[model samples]
Target: MHPSTLMMGYGYEPRLSEGALKPPIFLTSTYAFESAADGKRFFEGITGKRPGGSEGLVYGRFNGPNQEILEDRLAQWERAEEALSFSSGMSAIGTALMAHVQPGDVIVHSAPLYAATEKMIDAVFGKFGVKWVDFPAHASPAEIEETIERAKGLGRVSVIYLESPANPTNDLVDIEAVSALRDRMFADAEHRPVIMCDNTFLGPCFQAPTQNGADMSVYSLTKYVGGHSDLVAGAVVGTRDALAPILALRNTLGTITDPNTAWMLLRSLETVQLRMEKAESNARAVATFLKDHPKVERVSWLGFLDPSSSQGEIFKRHCSGAGSTFSVIVKGGEPEAFRLLDNLKTVKLAVSLGGTESLASHPAAMTHLSVPEARRAELGIGDNLVRVSIGVEHEDDLVADFEQALKAV
Candidate 1:
């Protein structure tokens, strides 16, 4: 069945909880065992001590009915063998990377990452004796090969991380090309680095990284997956083998999303496709308007990519649609960008994206402020750049909002 169809009822049974059509939130912290033997069996199953049947829940941190149901549905959507949920997107990413890398291991990642993620890799991980190297998201296949070779010279490459339709810039990394490069470089090695992709920008509806050879696909469910901007959650979906260690780490870190948030995600999944479709349509209209506006200097939207470009070819090969998030460069610098953002009536000046309501934010001063000015410029995140996340609003209303805001600029 189609993912949209499965969202309505998959992995859920109405008869299990007093005939409730919607699954009731299991708010308990622990589950009661039928017998001492049953408790032992559950523990054994979780610990992989014994293979058995009728294994039931042990604790909320370990497992819950709501978490299980949501994980199952998310796995199905991504065509992954298993799925795990986390308290936040960084928790999922940090735990997954930590699970795979040792103290001396190296991580090769794409540049222009989310500010928090970049800080974690370049600063926190470095202090712990792990090393990292970065390649541009638009790096050619040859450039990627050189980056990997350089990292290999430093230490063992344990992971290759990528974020496509990269945060605030709409830059894309070719998943298949990177995966093939990893395979060829590590053909004879005993341990091969895992390829992980952050799919939050495009969401599950727009792209599936697992289909393009990613060992894992990570998401900030707080974004498009939650849709209403009311919940915060994260998810990692991939093969059961690839996820086992990450799940163990998540369990130890106690980063599982609460039952209530899991329930909210379940509700959001049902309408995600519909919400994304409308937002994509609205974004195309808004981007087109920005491209033609006299006050706009440049628009960085995937839908506007030149078909003859390499990034465009990779996007056509891997993605189903150009998602709603993109960045616009205003004609002037910080002062003018602030004027436009401050004058926007319909679109809120905010940091987060992929919500139901339109949002506009200045990356240099807001989301990526921690990044140095030189690095920001290299990533095309300038003082005049405003990241816009189109919502499910009518196209005309959204365009009118931008029109008036540009007038202020």
Candidate 2:
């Protein structure tokens, strides 16, 4: 069955709880053991002495039916063998990276990363003695190889992390090329770098990173997965073998999403595809409107990629749809961008993307503020850049909003 079809009821049995159509939230701190022998067995499973069966739930943090069901659904969506949910997207990224790397190890990542992630790698992880190197989003396959080789000169390349259709700016990273690069670089070595892709911008339906040779796929479930801005959550999905260590770290660090949030995700999963499709439609219309506007200097949207360009070819090969979030460079700098943002009536001025309501923000001062000025310029996150997250709204309404807002500038 299709993933969206399966999402309606897969991994959940209606007969389990009074024939309830929806899974009820298991809002307890822990579960009761059937017997002392059963408790022993559960603990043995937790300690790896025995295989862990899905039937038993020992504690909320360790396991829960809501979390398990949600994980199962997410794994199904991404075509993954297993999945782990986290309290936030950063927890998922941090725990997965920490599980794979140690002191003196190096991480090779693509630039224009989400600001928080860049800070975590450079400021927090750097203090812990792990080093990081970055290649530009549009780096050629050969340039990526050189970057990896340079990182290897310092230490093992433990992780190759990438955020494609990168935050705010819709830059495409070649996932298959990076995966091949990892294989070529580590052909003779016992240790291999794990390729992790952050698929938050496009979501699971638009792009499946694992299918493109990524070892693992990560997401800020707070965005499209939740569909509403009411909850904060994240997810990691991959083969069971690839996710084992990350899950182990999640268990120890208590980074698991709570039962209520898991339940919310479960509810959101039912309609995510519909919401995303509508948003994509709206985005296409909005991008077209902005492209023809006299005040708009340039628009960075996946749909607008020149077919002859290398990035466009990569996008054609990997991504199925041009997602809703993209950037617009106005005629002037921050003052003009801020004026347009401040004048928008339909789209709210906000930070996060992939929500039910449209949002717009100045990336230079908002989302990527932590990045150095020079680096931001190189990434094309200019003072005139304004990022927009198109929601499932009427195309005409959104276009009119942008028209009036641009006039304010």
Best by lDDT: 1
Q: Estimate each model's TM-score.
A: 0.98, 0.98
lDDT string for model 1 (119-161, tens) is 9888988887889889999999999999999999998899999
Q: At residue 19, what lDDT does model 2 achieve?
A: 100
RMSD of each: 1.3, 1.1
Position 7, candidate 2: lDDT: 88
The TM-score between candidate 2 and the true structure equals 0.98
Give one digit per residue, the lDDT tens place, for model 2 in 17-71: 8999999999899888889888988877665667544347888767899999999
Pairs that collide, model 2? none
Clash pairs (backbone) in predicted model 1 = none
* lDDT, candidate 2, at 208: 92
lDDT of 2 at 307: 84
